[model samples]
Target chain A: MIRVRDLTIRVGSFALEGVSFTVAAGRYAVLMGKTGSGKSTLLEAITGLRPIEAGSVELLGRDVTRLKPADRGVGYVPQDLALFPTMTVREHLAFAQAIRGWDRTPTEQRVAELADLLGIDHLLDRQPQGLSGGEAQRTALGRALSFRPRVLLLDEPLSALDEETREGMYDLLRTVHRETGVTVLHVTHSLTEAKKLGDCIFRLADGKIGEMA
Target chain B: MSSRRRGTTPSTGRSDVPFLVALGVMGGFYVLLIVGMLVADVLSTTPGHLWALLKNRDIRYSIKLSLISCTITAILSVWVAVPLGYLLSRYQFRGKALLDVLLDIPIVLPPLVIGLCLLILFSTPPGRGVQQFVQVTYAIPSVIIAQFAVAAAFAVRTMRVAFDQISPRQEQVALTLGCSRSQAFWRVVLPQARQGVLTAGTVAWARAMGEFGPVLVFSGTTRGYTEVLPTTVFLELSTYSLEGAVAVSVLMVIVALVVLLIVRVYGMGSAPVGGR
Candidate 1:
């Protein structure tokens, strides 16, 4: 479970004031808001990328507010998927393992497993440059799962995809959530996605969580 | 011959008429100069003396010294510049523009002024802070310092631009994957900027290797000590060793050509990946 209490942050010309929410374990919690509604900022604040002026974040009943982003055990999939361009897909898989100081063999196996699960096994040899929208998102998802993060944060993951691909990705994401049982905090402006996938909906306006459904 | 026709207009269908005309004028001059130089160098190469000049001790020392010091500068410059470049590119902090401008100062200064400044700063007791601390004055170390000053400036500028071209979104995704900031940087960001880094390093090293004025002032023009290729050429030309000087010139040209060819090959291989 993840609990965020009274989170506040001030960026240039934008501010989030006293935002708070709770996402139950294995539950899909979607934050719905229009552009510049602090939906992304809330995610960033929870991940420690943005400085919270006043707040406390609790993950699995542990106070993670003071912890660095690396120590949070939280997976963040930015809107763009941020795969390293210099590496082949295979090398990126290896790097995911290498970063955690995990064994090389197990890392390879896990990469294979994730690739298979995400339907990107064939693209393992390719670079991010050649990846299609769906493929890139899958690879990004695979990279996030390699470390077995306790919670996954998705920032408008479906927005960049075409209509067809976005629908496919939504289905894939639903299946992945069911199989993995990871806590998901998905941010989106689309009310339809919120109604379809969210077990609970939190409406954010002017950087505050107004109400929950 | 029955139905073929050709005109001054380009047939490839890119028709920015004014831009193409401007590009043609500049490009034409550049091509003409290069072709003229290549022809001249080829025509001037006499077999008998070219072989004999290679045997000279001073010539050999100049070539050897130039390669060694410039290489050292390149290595050091890249070592420091990579991290600095990445930081500057990725982070928003106080005084960023000032820091950038300071790093770029070496590139804007005249090479002769740089040498003069090095001479003053490393010369004696009062202004010898660097010499006292590191003891690189009037030696190969001074030459390295001079080369590093310029080379690092070039590298930082190149890498900064390269890193800017890459979106920060890539590393942010890695961070969400439980990777540390450094891990994300090494795995995602650095690899993405690899070609830019390579191109920058190549340009920096080439610039350093061909540097003459600053190196001469800082390292001195002593034979087998600080006498790099250009300095040796100057010494030879001054002392009326005209053939020897020409031979050194020919050697410099050859080395430069080889480096250019290597950069071209590497660049071509890497170019396609960054386009997308």
Candidate 2:
């Protein structure tokens, strides 16, 4: 389970105040908000990229508020993918495995499996620049999962995809979630995606978070 | 016949043309000057003498010294510049504008003034006293220090611009991916900024290699020890070794050409990032 309490951040012209939330272990929670609604800021504060002026963020029953991102054991798939453009898809998976101290043979086998599962087995040698939005998203997902974190954070994972791809991604994400049983906190403004993928929904507006039926 | 009002704009004419022409002319002049110098010097030296000069002991030693010292300068420059540039690019703080202006001081200050200041400070007992630890007066250390000061200022400016051009979102993503601040920088941010950093390194190294005034003032012309390419040229000219001077200048031009080629390659790769 992941829990956030009294999370507040003062960015340029906006402030997120006293926001609190909880995600049951192995559940998919969607955060729905328009642009600049502090959805991304909340994610950042949780990830420790942005400092939280007043907050306690706990992941999988451990206090991770002061911990570095690597030590926090939460996988994040950013909106832009942030896939190292300089690296090939296979290399991205390999790097994640390497950083987590996975052995080479197992890492390679795992990477192969993930690539096959994402249907990007043929695109492993290619760079991110050459990949389509859906392909890149798959690569990013592969990278995040290779680390096998206790929690997964998806920041607008389906935003760049076309409608057809978005629908396909929803299915893919659902399948992956069920197979891995990884708790997910997905941030998006799409009502359709929220309704489709969210087990529970949290509406974020003007820096406030409220649970919705 | 209808008035053919196709694509011409009356207001966008003289305003742009005059300014662009002025800018073009200013840039053209430097290109011409450098080309003219390289052509003149290479032409003046006999091919045989030029070949021999390339093989000369003195020329070889100066080349080695220049390459080594300038490389050290670039490495140290990047070391100091990276953190400072990253901080300046990413955060807004008190006195940031003042700090930015201070970094620019070495770029615009006359090299002679920088040399004189170094000399005045280092030549005195107090300066010498401080120097006792590092022992920079009239030494290779002083040469590296001079090059590092000027080149680091240049690196800070270029690198900060490069870092600024990268989106903060990338680092944010890295964080969410479970990377610490330093890890995000090491894995994601630095990898993205590699070409920019390499270009800055080449430019800084070239500038350090060709450094003259401050080096001459601080580390005087001690052949085989303190002398670099430009200083070698100056020494050869005073000693009436015109062929040797021209030869050294030719070598300097070749080094600069290589740097330019590297920059061009980096520029091509970096263009797409900027376009985004």
Candidate 3:
């Protein structure tokens, strides 16, 4: 479960004012917002990338408002996917495990499992440059899932894909959620994407979060 | 197949031809001037004379000292440049513009002025305190310090550009993937910066190797002591050994070309990886 209570963040002239939201455990929650609605900013605040001016971020029933990003145990896949260009697909998947001090055998097994789960095993040796949009998204998903964080923060992870590819990714994302039972907070402007994937939908507007009917 | 057309196009309608030709001639003349001098030196000096100059103990010592000191200066410059450049690139703070201008002073100021400033600093209380612990002025260490004063500015400039080119998004993603801030920097940012660092190092080394004014003023170009290649050229020229000076200049040119070649090769190999 993830809970953000009255989270307010200011970045230069833009501000997210007293925004709050909650996603039940294991639910695929979609956050709908227009451009410049502070969707990405809110996600960054949750991940501790952006400092909250007020209020708190709680993850899995723990107060992690002041925790460092690495200590927050939140997996984030930004809009760009932001893959490390120098690293191979395998390295990308293994990075979180290595950083979190996972044991080698289990880590390898987890990487293999994620590769299989994401259907990126064939692209394991390739770097980000060689990957297609769908493949890169899969690799990013695999990387986010590598550490098995309690919540996954997806910032328009499928926005760059074509219609066909986006459909595939939506299915893939839903399947992954059902299989792993990990909570997801997916941010997007696409109403269709929300209707198709969200167990719970929250609309973000005017720097506030309101649960949809 | 198109040779006839290619040969006639410039003469037919290209009004820029005259301007291009004039520009080319001026560029060629400037290059030829330097090349012609080097050629003239080569023609006048015999193999025996070059060998003797190379074998001179003072020249040999100066060459060795230049290589060692320049290499150290290059390493130290990059060592300082990386973190400093990252800070300058990624952060906004009060007096940042002033700090940037301060970093650039060594690059723009007359080298002798920098040497004078160092001399003045070392004579002060804090400078004397440092000198009491370790010799600086008129010492070999001063050669490196002087070189570093200018070379580090160049390195910092190169590294700032490098860090500026990398998106902070990559580092953020690394942090989200369980890397601490330092971990993200080392794993993500540093690897991307490797080519820039190498380029900065070589450029700094080349600059340090060729630096004369600061070394002369601050370190003192004493033979078998603090003399380096550029200082050796000065000493040789003062003694009316034009051949010896040209030889040293040629050696410096060769070293610079080799470093540049390495940088080119490195840049080529890493270009694809850094495309992001």
Q: What shift in Å separates residue A148 of candidate 3 from its native position after superposition? A: 0.5
Q: Can you rank all candidates by TM-score, best first? A: 3, 1, 2
Worst 10 residues of 1 chain B by lDDT: B1-10
In candidate 3, which residue pairs clash?
A: none
Query: Best TM-score goes to which candidate?
Result: 3
**lDDT score, residue B205, model 2?**
90
Model 2 RMSD vs true structure: 4.4
Positional deviation of A42 in candidate 1, in angstroms?
1.4
What digit string (tens of lDDT, one per residue) describes model 1 on residues A55-105? 899998889999888788887888877777666777666665777788878
Candidate with top lDDT is 3
Q: Which portions of model 2 miss their true places by more than 4 Å?
A: A61-63, B1-30, B49-57, B91-99, B124-135, B223-225, B239-247, B258-276
Better of 2 and 3 by DockQ: 3
lDDT of 2 by residue, B1-276 (tens): 558776665655456788899999989999999788778988887778767877888878888888899999999988888888899999899999999999998899998778888888887999888887887978889899888878999888888988998888767656655566787789777877776677678778988987898999888999888988999999999999887788778878887788678778867866444333
lDDT of 1 by residue, B125-165 (tens): 76576667676767878888888888888888888888888
Whole-model lDDT, model 2: 0.84
Query: What TM value does the first chain of each candidate achieve?
Result: 0.96, 0.97, 0.98
Candidate 3: segments with Cα more than 4 A from true spot: B1-49, B266-274
Categorize the docking of model 3.
medium
